[model samples]
Target chain A: MLRLSNLHKRFGQVVALGGLSLHIPAGCIFGLLGPNGAGKTTTISIAVGLLAPDSGEVDLGHGGTPERAEVRRRIGVAPQAIALYDDLTARENLDFFARLYGLSGPQRRERADALLARVGLSDRADHRVKGFSGGMKRRLNLAAALLHDPPIVLLDEPTAGVDPQSRNAILEMARSLRDEGRTVVYTTHYMEEAQRLCDRVAIIDRGRVLAEGTVEQLVGTLGGSSVVTIQTDEGDTRIETADPVGELGRRLAAPGVRGVRVERPDLEAVFLHLTGRSLRD
Target chain B: MNAVLAIAIKDIRLLLRDRMGFFFSFFFPLLIAVFFGVVFRGGGGGGGAGSGIPVAVVDLDNTAESAAFAAKLIAASELEVTTGLSPTEAEEAVRIGRLRGSIVLLPGFGEARRRPFWGEPMSIELAVDPSRAALASMLEGVVTRHAFEGLSEMFADPAKMRGQVRESMDQMRRDGSLPRAMRPAFEMFFNALDSMLQTVQEDSAGEPGEAADPAQAAARAGGWQPVRVSTRAVSARPSGLPTNSFALTFPQGVIWGMMGCALGFAITLVMERTRGTLLRLRIAPLSRMQILAGKAVGCFMVTASVAATLMVIARVVFQVQPTSVIMLAAAIACSSACFVGIMMLLAAVSRTEAAGNGLGWGVLLLMAMIGGGMVPLEFMPGFIRTLSVVSPIRWSLLALEGGVFRGFSMAQMAAPCGVLLGIGGMSFAVGARLFRPD
Candidate 1:
């Protein structure tokens, strides 16, 4: 579990994060959904001690003083960019990080081999990362972050440029990490991923968290309504109601109702309804 | 510590895999050494025969004496003489550096020599370049010796000698005092001289068919003829290690090669910073000092390896005989440390890979040029040689040369090694302060 309070960061005249705060519960996939330049990466960077907040403290759910070394040992960071040596093989990269994490000799080798197999990269473990595809590199990057098996994992857009298969695999990996009772902080622009994988989600924009709740609860805040449309001989009629099926039955009783459709408010519509802007913006 | 070793090991592995880096660090300098070694092999003045001092001769007399003198010059093996030039032409050649100096025999040289101890003294003119004044003086001595030998033979007749002795005795008696103890010595000398004159007259009477004058007999034998003069260097090299050019150049080549390592590593640090690897390491559990220390260790290993390889190649291919292996190793270690510190300073000063590379090569090449990496310090001007003391490369090369051939004592070796270590320590301290973690 990680807790960030009153985090303030600035780059020259631009305010990257201004009085931002959030609490991520343990053993859950917590999604920080935001548009580009939404302070998600900045917040994560502060939590990982890569960038220090101007006036804030990061508590790592520990009673003792939270030193940078102890916090780093307990957390793993998969940065936004593919931060790896292209000249080294995947196995060698893993082995190097493992050593940095204080793993030695036999333990380092076993962990690297197991991670290669877990990431489905056993066949290409010996090949340099320079020759790997975008999808394979993303997978290996994820495996490298989890190489030390830290209890807290921070993934900042791990599937930004990945293909659908790699994207699905990464989403599945995040779910599995949550199921294994580890704290997962996933930052992304994809609203559907938050809907499917995250147990709790926070929508952030311009260095502030706009809303935070469960999927149903956040959608309930959007008035708990469904959109119903009826196509008739004259034209199409649109209707907003709390119960789409009951409204459809009532609309069928009227004349010249050829077809009926019902749509529940998804997280995207909820986000648009709540913030008066599209999530992608 | 393990993390530091891991980083150093990884850096070395990556450097080795870079083929272009390897070539510049090792083979390129080796090729330079070989090319220069072959080109300058015979040019060294190793005090050997046939390495003649270049000069010209102008014979204006056109007489048998002058012709015989020219012939004598041609016969002397040491002199590489260019003949058949006029005085004006020889002087022009000397002025233009085509010759080191020139010898000119005046037109009346033969006639002047015939009258022994009189008539306008015939002088041979020596025209030389001012830069070669020392060489010109040596050549003058050789020509004077030839002239004296001819004079001694030309005045060999007993009658002429007796006349000159009596004339000298009469002058001394009139102008100065003969010691009281030496009056009998002069009387005995006059009696012995008359007896020698009678013996010479009897010998001439016995050999009536021969020339009456002993000088005429000597002239007939060609011994009293004008002595033909020529000049040549007895030995080319006056001092230092035997004239092998390779022995002189390999040390400089090794320095250049080691400098290549510094340039390569400096550029590597910049690349690591720009590529985000440095940020990743900073975020890791390792401390900042550990990362820098690892990189420094890697640079030292590579530089020392390059220096050792060059030495081995010099010994095998160029036949450079090293004087002390232990001293040479120490020199290499100290030089590597100096360059590694230089690499750190380069990295700290430049903000990007391109700037780092440009600054690294610019500074290194400047140091190399001033420090005698491309040309030996012996060929440089006084001020440039004096300014070379500021260059770390100069100290490194001097230390290496001392270890290889100068046969430096332990105390002598300490001076250069201490300076090198001092440079490394100072550069590292300043560079560390300037290093940016970003």
Candidate 2:
């Protein structure tokens, strides 16, 4: 379990975290969703003790600020960048990180082997990181972080440059961690990843929490009775402040519209309606 | 303890695997050591023989005596004489450093034997080039002694002049065989002969008044009588053919290699910082100090191992054995610490690994050049040698050479070690202050 209250951070004149708050219960896959330049990374960084917030407090488990060592002992971090020695073998890399977590000798070897197997990289464990593909490196990076089997895992866009197969495998690993009663905090700009993986989601932008809820709950909060999407040859795609579904449905019926379906807002529609911008933007 | 060992092991492994780093840190020094060792080992007063020395011959008179004197000079081993070289050529050679000196034989130099002591006698002159000042004095003494010997031999040839001396002596003895009036004439002649014998004796004894009193003679010989330098080194300065330029340069090479290790790992630190590896590590609950300590310990271990290996090789292969085991260990430790500290400082300020590496190696090379690693300090000016005192290479060399050369007492060795330790402590403190987690 983790709780962040009224966290605030600033870099020179720019606010990175504007009194943002987050709560994560035990044994759940929690997603912190945002676009580029959002405070998702800053929040994650502060929680992990890499960056200290200008204001507010962080609590772990039973509602108290976690000691640095205690937090380190119980948490595994998969950084956004490749945190591996290119000259070292995948197994050696795993063994090194495992040693940092205080595992030694036989225990380190055993955990390194197991982690290699878990990541589907046992056959290539002895290969140097320099020879690995982007996806393979990403997998090895994840394996290294998980070598110590900590109680909590923080993954920062672990599948960013990975292949779809690798991404799916990583998603499965997150599910397995949750099932094992480990709290997972996943940060990414990919809405699909969050929608598919997170039990609960917090949408953040410009260092502030925009919304926090289940995916369905967030969509319902958009307050739209029905949603309609129309592809037209006309340049103007904007619908004026009238009943969008009514006007769109009338237009479809009058013209050569091929498909029409009334619907509740999807995550993309909800995201646009709430933020006044496209999800990709 | 285990953490330190792990970091150290990892660093050494990495260093060995890096081909460029390995060569710079080890092989380059080995090459330099071999080069300088061969060039500087003593033979005919440093830099070996056939190193091109100049001698000037000045003939004031065209007589046989002077010409014969010049011929003897040309015949002497180790003297290179130029017959056509004018006084200007001789002066220019000494001036521009082409010639070491010129020999001038004054007109009637042979007549100095026939003259009484009054004004300055007609003597051979030795003109020297001051640029090679150290060699000039030595050459002056050598050439002057040779000229005097030749002049003496020219006057002493008895077989060619025996008839003139014997005729005069026979006439004097016959006249002495007369009465009282003739006895007075014979006594005067005998007194004249007595004076000539005394002059010969004085000349043979080399300028009579110049001989020192017994006390003065004893004092003059005392300073250099026992010319032994007390050294603590296990082995003496090796006998036989002297070491070359490579051997002389080897210590510097070792210091340079150690510096390379520091520089290489400093780049690694900068890379970690720029790539957010450091930030991520910090988040994992490791304190900033632990991260820094890990890196420093790793680099130190690599440097120490390299130094120790170099020492072993120097001893077994090159016959270099440092006398004081404790001093050897201490010097290595101090140098390693200094190198680590320097790296930490470079890493702390650099925004990127490339920048750090460039700056670190640039500074290292500059230091090596000035510290007498590339060129001998003997070739450098006094001011340059004075400046080199601050270089880490200077201390490293002194400490290492002291171990093998046995050229220092504890009193002499203390300053070098002290300066090395001082440098290590200062750098370590500065580096520690600058080190930050992020």
Candidate 3:
């Protein structure tokens, strides 16, 4: 579990994080969704002790606020960029990070090999990362983050430039981490990824969380609107209503109406309704 | 500790994998050293030991005194003298670069010695190639030295010197303006000179010949003879190994090699930061200071290794003598440490790899030029030589030369080594303060 309270960070004239707070429970896949420059990375950077907030407190399952080393030992962070030595082999990169976490000898080698295999890179384990594809490097980056097997995992847009297959694999990996009772904090611009993998999601904008809940609950709070369209003899008739079932039945009763269709709002519409802008805007 | 070693090992491995790094840090410097060493072998004053300057001698006097002086000039270790050449022939040899210079002894050289105090102004003409001025000056020095020695020997005979003294005193006494009080002192002086002349006459009584003139008498006694002016040109021949050229250039090559290491590793550090590896390390359990220390250690190790490799190559290819292995090692360590600190400072100064590389090489080349990388310090202008003390390369070269061929004792080595270490410490402190992992 991790808690960020009253985090206020500034970069000269810009406010990166303005009194943002979040509580992530254990064994949950928590998604922090925001557009570009939405304080997601700033928050994750503060959480991992990479950046100290101007004013904030970070608790990583400790009674009191922990030091940077303590927090680093408990959290595994997969940065947005492929932070690896291009000259080193995939296995070597893993082994290096494992050693940095105090793994040694046979145990270090074993962990590195296992992680390489887990990421489906066993065949290319000995090859330098410089020759790896974007997706393969992304997978190895994820594997490196988990080399220490920390209880709290932080992934910041891990699949930003990855292919669909690698993206799916990363999403599945996050799911598996939650299944193993490990707390997962993921940030991404893809709404579908959050819809599929996150048990609890937070939509942030301008350094503040606009909404936080499960998909259904957040969509429910958007008035649960549904769009109805009827194919009439004259033309197509459309209506937006909350009671889609009753409204569809009534619309079907109209004369010369060939068919009626109803569509419920999804997470995209809920996010737009709360932020008053598109996710990418 | 393990983490620190791991980081250092990783960095070294990366450097090894980089071909450009390998070339610049090791192969390139070796190539330069070997090339220059071969090209400038025994060429100038900086040329190595045992190689003398090539010169020609034209002895027109052809007297016994002239021949003896020529023999003495020929026996000098610094001059490779050629004899039995006419003046025109010796001048032609100098003109065609066959010799560094030529010396021509005039016909009256031996006659002038017979009356040195009132003789025709004897001139020992030196004709030298314009391009070999330093060698010409040195040749002039050799001729001048022989002339002075001949004069001293001619004046050494007590009989001839006493005769000159008595003649001068008699002239002074004949002048009535001579003070009455100075007469007693002059008398005492004449008495001492007469006594010395009597002793020489008694000693030379066994000789059969007698001459009224003091010059002839001294010449007959074989005590004082006519002065001889010897003229000889000197040139150099290539003697393999331990030449001054190699001695001066080898340390310069080592400094360039170290500079290459510094520039290469400094750019690598910038690359790591820009590529996010530095941030990743920061996110790891290692402290910020540990990460920097690891990188510094890695640079130091690589630099020292490059220096040692260059030194060994110099020893093998250029026949550079290793004066003291321990002192050499200490010099290498101190030099490497200084460059490692410079590398850190360079990394701290530039934000991008391109900028860092450009700035690093700019600083290094400037330092090299100022510190006698292209020219020996002894040949540099006075102001430039004075400014060379500010260049860290100068100190490194001093320490290395001291250890290699300068035969510096432990006490003599302390100043250079201390300056090198001081530079390293100061640069490291400033660079560490300015460095930012992000």
Candidate 4:
């Protein structure tokens, strides 16, 4: 579990995190959803003690900040950029990070092997990371984050630029980590991912959380009722209502209806309605 | 500690995988060492037949005094003189740059030497090449030193000095060189010298003017070889050939090898930052100090290992033996520490891999050029040698040279080793203070 209270970070004239506060609870996939440049990476960075905030406190649920080495040991970070030594083999890379976490000798080797197999990279364990495909590198990067099996894992856009297969594997790994009762802090600009994977989601923009709730709860809060559009010879009639089934039945029984469409509310609609701009922008 | 060791080991493994780094750090220096070793071995052994400064000591005077002066030129461990060459031949040699210069002992040189008491000016012509402006002065100093030594040797022989004084006095009595008013003083001085010479030369008492043992005197004078000087610098400045050419060149090899390691490691630090591994490292359960210490230790280990490998190759393949193993170890440790500190400073200043590799190596190359790693300090210009004191390479080379062949004792070795450690400490402190952990 990680608790960041009133975090304020500035990069010269640019404000990276504007009085941001986030509390990622234990044993759940807690998603920090935002558009690009929404302080997601900065929040993760501060949470892992990689960058100190200008002002505010980061509590790792251990009565101390991640600035302390022992507190950092309880958390794992998968940075947005693929952080790996290109010259080292996958096994060597894992073994190295494993050793940093205090694994040694046979234990180091075994952990590295297990992680390699877990990421579906056991066949290429001896191959240098330099020769790996982008998707393969993404998988290896995730494995490296899980090398030490820490209590909490912070994954910063783990599936960015990965192939579909690697994306599936990474998503599955995140699910497995959650199933093992490990707290997962996932940061990304992808709205659908948060809707599908996260138990609780917070939409952040300009370094401040706009909304925090379950996906259905967020959509219900601001997404409004589903829009029922009925196209007839006269024209199309649009209606916003909670009872879509009864409305659709009445529309079907009515005079000539050329076409019909039910636009259900989702996170995209919730983001657009809340931010007045598309999430991709 | 475990994390630190892991980082250090990882860096070393990466370096080994880089072909260019591996070659420059190991095989390139080895090539330089082996090539220079073979060349110096053939010529630098204690003034072997043709060692030292190559020049022609043409005796135009052809007298016993001039010949003895020429022999002194050959006796000096600094010059390698060719006696039989005519003035024309020597001049041509200088014109073509085959020799450094030529010194002609003209006609009146012997007469001037025989009657030095009369203030007779010696005739000499030192035809130094135009390109070598300092050559004239350097040769003159060497030749004049030998001439002054001859004068001193004449004085040491009371009888010979007395003979010269009497001849000068007779000439002065017949000629108007001495004024009439000063005639008595000059005669009195000459007569007093003759009397002292007679008493001292005839005295059997072994005090004051006792006869020197011929064998001991010859040994002290370094055995008059009339045409060449031997390598005495091999035994730390006092006659003999360098027994191993590798001894003369391996120190230079270590210097270049250290440069490669320093620049390579510096670039690696920058690369890690640029590639974002530094972020991962910082996020890991390791402090900034531990991370930096790991880097410094890695560079130090690699630098020291390269030096040790070069020395081992020198001993095994080139038949070179260290003067003292303990002193050699001390030199390597201090020098490696200094370069590791330098690597830290370079890494702190470099924001990218290109800057670390290009700018850092450029700085090191300049240091090597000024510090006698690129060329012998003796042959370097005066300004360069003066600037060399600031370059760590100068101290590294000096320490290594002392260990390899300079035969420096522990007490003698303290200065260079101390300076090396001092540089290492200062650079590391400054680098660590300036390093950015982002």
> Which candidate tops TM-score?
4
Model 4 in CAPRI terms: which quality?
Answer: medium
- TM-score of decoy 1: 0.72
Runs of candidate 3 with Cα error greater than 4 angstroms are A63-67, A230-235, A245-261, B44-245
Task: Give the higher-lDDT candidate: 1 or 4.
Answer: 4
- Which has the higher DockQ value, candidate number 1 or candidate number 3? 3
lDDT of each: 0.76, 0.68, 0.79, 0.81
**Residue A107 lDDT, candidate 4, scale 0-100:** 89
Query: What's the lDDT for residue A107 in model 3?
Result: 86
> Per candidate, chain B TM-score?
0.58, 0.57, 0.60, 0.62
lDDT (Cα, tens digit) per residue for candidate 4, span A75-172: 88888999999999999899889888888689888888888889999999999999999899988888888877888999999999988999889989
Candidate 1 docking class: acceptable
Models sorted by TM-score, best on top: 4, 3, 1, 2
Residue range A111-219, candidate 1, lDDT tens digits: 8898888778999999999999988988888888887788999899888999999899899999988988999999998988988989998888888888888878887
Q: Which one is best on lDDT?
A: 4
DockQ-based class of model 2: acceptable
Q: Kindly list the per-residue Cα lDDT of model 3 for residues A1-281, writing each as its tens digit.
A: 88999999999999999999999998999999888899999999888877889998999886434356766888888999889999999988988888888886898889888888888899999999999999999999999899888999999999999899998889889998899899999998888888888999998888988888887788778725888988888988789888888988887777898877777787788778887888878
Q: Compose the digit string of candidate 1's lDDT tens values, residues B233-343.
A: 221122333435675577777888888888888888888788867766776787778888888998999999988988898888777776667778888999999998998
Ranked by DockQ, the better of candidates 2 and 4 is 4
Better of 2 and 4 by TM-score: 4
